[model samples]
Target: MTANTHDRGAPAAPARRSGLGVALFLEATERFSFYGMLSILLVYLLDVRGLAAPRANLFVGSFNALALVSTLLGSRLGGVVLGPARTVLYGCAIQFMALVLLGLSVMWPVLFLPAAAAVAVTNGLTRTNMAVLILRHAGGGRSADGLATLYTFAVNLGAMFSFLLVPWIGRRHGYALAFGACAAGLFMGAAAALLNRRALAGGASGGTARAVPRAVAETGLAIVSYWVVLNFPAGGHWIFWLVTSAIPVFWAWAWRNATPAERPGIAICLILVAEAMFYGMFDEQTTSTFVLYALHDLNRQFSVAGVTLFELDAPQIVAINAGLTMLLGPVFVVLYRLVDARFGTVALSVKYVCGSVFIVIGFLVLCLDTAGGAPGLRAPWGMFGAYAALSVAGLIMNGLGLSVVTTYLPARMRTMSVAVYYISTGLAMYGGSVLANAMGIGRLHAATPIPESLSTFHALFRGFTLLAACGAGGIVLLLPVLRRLERRAG
Candidate 1:
């Protein structure tokens, strides 16, 4: 958005190497530390925390959804009242305390919800701010999309290691130790940014700092009120409703001030937000139903050069997907550039179509492999193959939304536009939750001793395949119109 003039005759701005490293490290640490804790959370709730599948899934969905949705509010707070630096500082401190509290929840159990909520709040404040800082200092040395791609790559790098390391710690040492490790990693990441805080300077112009204290107090009160509501008999239902209610609120908020020139681009952003729900559901398979399947159903046995290794299980299998993302990221970037050169720039909608197609392919593999295995364990290839395709799709969609919106949306609304991209992920979590509850996937029936993880997941995976196919079809149908809109908006 800063005119991205690397190709102009003017000399490209120099890279702030330390700032760039801190930003990338911060992004990497977030993925590693956050996913390290979360990859185990579903099972932790179901078994260690002694909750039923429905409740476990709901809790997982609720916390993750809350985390993603809070970014809108967090971005507003950072871009305005509290200032981005102070917001990051407070956010990291909150997350550190949250990790500690969640670690303590292993003993008390009651502490988990508030801690989870705090993590949600932390998401609002910190992660998106990191991207802003990266763009802030990246200057003409890198394109904005390249910075976005680098951040995605950084995520997988962290995830690749965290998935391997943190889970082992969780399994061998103690659950609490794993969480504590995550806390330490996040703390270190925050410290890295603190060391280079001056580099993260712009973007806090709108509201006065005097508003910070009152806003924090109001936010605290709201959180406490929401927490109290969550403890009620039908709390989860109300929470889902509460979030769904936010969709239109965000739409109006984002578009209310848009000029006619920016309207089409903003409209496309919202459409992408909706389309993301499908992929989001697909994306969540790793954490929720996929983990459950690995636990109760899959034949996870494997050998490497006749040396027996740890059987692939929940987070470990999930780690394999992250590894794929890391490995495939650069390859896709090069391929995309080559394609762009041969053919003119690929349309953002086209990339999304490819993403949806790949998701369908992944689900189809799952459905085909899981066929007739309602009572047993199929080869791990089904799971492995599914992730292989989905990982590619993930890379394609990475900077597509942010990069497009950044290009076309008014600069005044940049933070909110970025926040809009996250709304899809937020809603995607809820949609997965809805799919789980409505269809009985991963739910344990009270009358039967056996949990229906395999059969339910089979049906659910099949349903997802259909949904993704429809999504792809819908996108393809709209390509002509979207292309016209993009040209007009451009």
Candidate 2:
């Protein structure tokens, strides 16, 4: 891989602006399709497909893991063989086909596996490359911060609308129609990519011909590995454990290979990645544990003056986080810029610490709320507050984490580094699913009495609270080291 493939010279100002717009559009639409399908997927599996909760959760977890792990191949393909623009277009096309099959799966049922696998594989092609394109267009300095904030803003904006609309459609019409909507969104994204091909092409690194065969081989290997993990019982857990154990070894090797100037940045990136992995375990609850809690435990109705306004379904609860993210994302961007102007740079350690606090607080809120009453139809305020806190935490941790990878890593490693970060998240999601299963979330049913489940919910929330508190303590202990590394990197 040549440097040009990863570090293409910045285009002229007008072209740069145009490319950023196209990239952001693609991001927004793609997220709309992805999250729209995801928000309702768990429920669909349980209700439509008639799977038990445990099996459904495992399926969802495995799908997320495969999607992220496959990004390694996708990043290589984009960075070496197809280039970013063509890779993104192909990803959109693949996703479109997969989603159509997913829609049809509502009728055929058997198509779900292959359709889901295709979607998972397509993610590897889109996400990392899109981030690379955004970075290339934005350039450096405060643009790094801006890119992080803006990228998250685009993501949540799409997510917010999807969560609000898709679940409602699924509830009223059917899961099939909702999935069809997602496919249509992908179609629009692909059309946009085609019309703006030149602008999107500007983001490519122009990878050399020599790398194509190697990239293809690696991509094929990833596909086969994903197939094995998806098909084999307990394979996802095995892969998760293997990856978790390998992370430290990989870090050591990279540290030894890095130059003195690169070492500090690499250290900082790894630390941030660790922090993200911890946070991601908690974040996954939004779709898994939290959704289950909302579905079974919360009263989702809204009323004014003794008149019912609207009722929120379990899946609709995810919109709260997305909505909060959209609102707060810009505030963070301004805050980051203001702090950087005053203090030379916003302290990444400070961001992590603050986010860790919110994580602990979010779980604590759930614990107290659960303990306050029987599990039957408690007020939704606790869920709202917890989701709000989590949204802030996510923006602080994940948004900054992405910025750190792009800003600090050598251009050549940016896509792979991003892919690695996502793989950590995939592992976290699988772990979170396991944790949810341990709490007997899969055993829960509508008929299960609140009194019977109280201990389980209480234990789960308390355990998460403790976990978050420990993560916070770890960050505190590492603060001096993180600061020293940041200074050295500068």
Candidate 2 displacement at residue 216 in angstroms: 7.6
Task: Give the deviation of candidate 1 from the true structure as CA RMSD.
Answer: 3.3
Q: Can you write out model 1's per-residue Cα lDDT over 1-490, one digit (the tens) per residue?
A: 2326222443223336556776788778877777887877876876686877777777777667767777776787767777666677677877888889888998888897777777777777776676666655434545555666777788898888887787778788878898898889888888887776655443234356678786677557545654664454236556657667877786787678877777787777677766666677778766777776666567776555756565766667788788899888777667766776799667778888888889889889987876673465665767888889988888767556566656556667777666756756776776687676676554554233222455666687888888889888998898887877787777
Candidate 2 local lDDT, 128-181, one digit each (tens)? 888877777554343676788888988898899899889999999998999999
The clash count of every prediction, one per candidate, is 0, 0
In model 2, what is the error at residue 337, expressed in angstroms? 1.4
Full-model lDDT for every candidate: 0.71, 0.81
Task: Please name the candidate that would achieve the greatest TM-score relative to the true structure.
Answer: 2
In model 1, where do residues sit more than 4 Å from their true spots?
A: 1-12, 137-141, 202-212, 222-226, 229-234, 253-256, 304-310, 373-375, 445-453
